[model samples]
Target: MPQKRRYKSRRTNYRRKSNKNNRTTIILIAIVAVFVVSFFGYRRYVQYQSESKVEMVQQDHSQFIKKVSPYAVELGRQYGVLPSITIAQAILESDWGTSSLASQYNNYFGIKGEDPSNTKVLQTKEYTNGQWITINGRFRVYSDFRESMKDHTKLLVDGTTWNSQQYRQVIQSKNYIDAAVALQTDGYATDPGYTNKIIRVIQKYNLKKYDEGIK
Candidate 1:
């Protein structure tokens, strides 16, 4: 009877120890799982914040055309030009007014000049010998965006003495499409698809109503 009692006590002790170890292991496993879930959840929260900021910035840029269009329409009307084409050209040439030249000096149209006081030397692209080449050139600078818009409109209507012929067809065009084509045909830009780019900008912004005098 004494031996039987000792054996039973030993067996009970062993089972009790095993149960305690198993409970400790389960607790540790639960702690690790909670930690892993928390870490990933925080990472996802940070990623969402970053993405939201970028989306807001992009939305601001997309609204640039709407913000600057009133000035474009006014300048276009003053010069007897189509506002839609003028605004589209501004959007494409200036990259919605985010280009280095446009941002720095308000030179949105990339007009070249020799004036010492209002000129900036920059590398520009030129098509030569069936290929495009980069060359250092002087571009006109403006004090403000308004000045740049006025000058750009005037340039299209009344070009320089040496290049007035280039804008003759453009100034004479009665519609936006014809104006875009005339600008392209007269080498307004080096891009082969400059006319298409202008048209695309106009369509994307729904700018044709300006040509129809719609508010």
Candidate 2:
């Protein structure tokens, strides 16, 4: 009877040990599953953020087009400047009116002015001596978007210098392509690819349609 009792006690201890081992194995598997799920969850979160940013970029583009297209058409009809080039330049220069200069002062054309009352002092990158240099430039400030557009058209039409004929080619050009090329040819912009950039913006936004159906 003592031997039987001893054997029963050993059996009970072995069962307890087996139960502990099984519990440990289950806990390890649970931890691994949690880790795998967390890793995939993080990846999905990152992908969602990237896609959201892309969507926001597209939204920004459409919003810009909606805001500026009508004004561009009106300005072109009044000032004889190519509407496509005008809108494209506004996009390129002001980054769809998102730049600090445009935001603070409504200065879309980068027009310089000495008026102390309506101006924004901005750090500009100028190409000088075959290199780019940062300089503080005073940009003209306007009361509204229409004023800004008016000022830009005035500059291209009347020109900045006393000689109001600095960019005559642009004013005389019949199409957006000619005006874009003329802007570069007449040293309106320092960048070598300025014309291409303007043309690219016009094409990307389908701004030529604004020029259409206008007398």
Candidate 3:
């Protein structure tokens, strides 16, 4: 009877140890799960912050476009051209008013003239002999930025001999893309991708709505 009681006590002790081990395993699993969830949550938060910053930068660019739109619209009203087209051209040609020529000479439209008496000579890059070569070229210089804008409008309205009529008709359509393409087809820019870039800038900032005040 003494031996049997001892054996029964030992069995109870083994069962208790097994239950304690199982509880410890469960606790470890719960801790690991919590740590994994926290890591993923932190990663998601970082991603959200990065995306928000990008969106804020884009908003700033849009605001800058808005600030410049009114002047472009007024210029168009005075010159009988499309406001968005004028703005896009200036932005493209002047590098958003950061170019040296734009700052110093107000020559945003890159107008060129052959008359040595009136033309200003500047060193610029030109494509020649299968490579880019720097050469002195004569470009039209304006006394004011407004004068450059005026000359750009005049070039579109009267100087273009091929598609002047088509551009004039499309400029009244209130569609920026149409007017941009008209300029491209009429050789307003030397770049083949000029029209697409203008369209992208206009659409990205929703610039066409400003034209409502022009009429």
- Model 3: residues with Cα > 4 Å off, grouped in runs: 1-68, 115-118, 125-135, 160-173, 213-215
* Candidates' C-alpha lDDT: 0.83, 0.86, 0.75
Better of 1 and 2 by TM-score: 2
Candidate with best lDDT: 2
Error of 3 at 174 (Å): 3.9
lDDT (Cα, tens digit) per residue for candidate 1, span 130-207:
799999999999999888788878888787768876688887888888889999888788788788888887887688
lDDT computed for candidate 2:
0.86
**Per-model TM-score versus the true fold:** 0.75, 0.84, 0.60
When sorted by lDDT, best at the front, the candidate numbers are: 2, 1, 3
Query: In TM-score terms, which candidate is top?
Result: 2
The stretch of ten residues in a row with the least summed lDDT in candidate 1 is 206-215
Candidate 2 C-alpha lDDT tens digits along 18-116: 999999999999999999999999999999999999999989888877887788888888888878888898888898889988877787778889888
As for candidate 3, its clashing pairs are none
Worst 10 residues of 2 by lDDT: 206-215
Instruction: Candidate 2: give the clashing pairs.
Output: none
